[model samples]
Target: MPETVLIVEDEFFIAMDLQLMLEGYGWRVMGPVGTVKDALLLLETELPSVALLDVNLGRELVTPVAEYLKAHDVPFAVATAYDRPEQYGGEVLAGVPNAGKPTDERRLMAALMQLTGR
Candidate 1:
């Protein structure tokens, strides 16, 4: 079975494009949810095999959502433009795989595949 991937990004067009891309690659795509609230709400009932998370959601940070995913043992990659670990709570996110903003489909898919051991 293809792996299921949850995507949490605030940018509307990017999110939709990612969804389509993942679907095209035969992976089941879940929410391109734009906020921590919505992403958390979706996490309440559905756990994707892996997740692609944006570090910032509008004015809010996605640390809480990342924490939740960690606790659940859900593998995830950070997708962001920022390079500072301080931007993500002082190295808490250091060494985590990053998909980077304006995501390169090849890199993103490779990161997710590595995380999922697929």
Candidate 2:
């Protein structure tokens, strides 16, 4: 079975772009969910092999989702415009792999591979 990836991003275009890219690479994509509530709801149903999270989701932060994923042992990477997402996400994101915004394909794929060990 193809590995599944959960994507937590608020921006519509960026989420669509990421969905297309990951699908093109032959992996199953779970969500490009925009909120912590949605992400957690999805997680309750199924766990992805890895996840990609955007640090900020409008008025809310992605920290709670990150914490949930961490506790579940689900590996994930952050996609952010910030040079240091940890500043916003706190210690939960200290050493987590980051796939910077504008979403470079190479870096994104590398982070995925690192997370999945594939």
Root-mean-square deviation per candidate? 1.5, 0.7
Global CA lDDT computed for model 2: 0.93
lDDT of 1 at 53: 85
**Would you estimate the TM-scores of all the predictions?**
0.91, 0.97
Which residue pairs clash within candidate 1? none
- The lDDT, on a scale of 0 to 1, for candidate 1 is 0.85
> How far off is model 2, as Cα RMSD?
0.7
Tens-place lDDT per residue, model 1, 90-112, is 35566678887888889888878
lDDT of each residue in 19-44, candidate 2, tens digit only? 99999999899888999999999999
What TM-score should be assigned to candidate 2?
0.97
Positional deviation of 99 in candidate 1, in angstroms? 0.9
Q: Clashing pairs in model 2?
A: none
The worst-scoring run of ten residues by lDDT in candidate 1 lies at 85-94
Supply the TM-score for candidate 1: 0.91
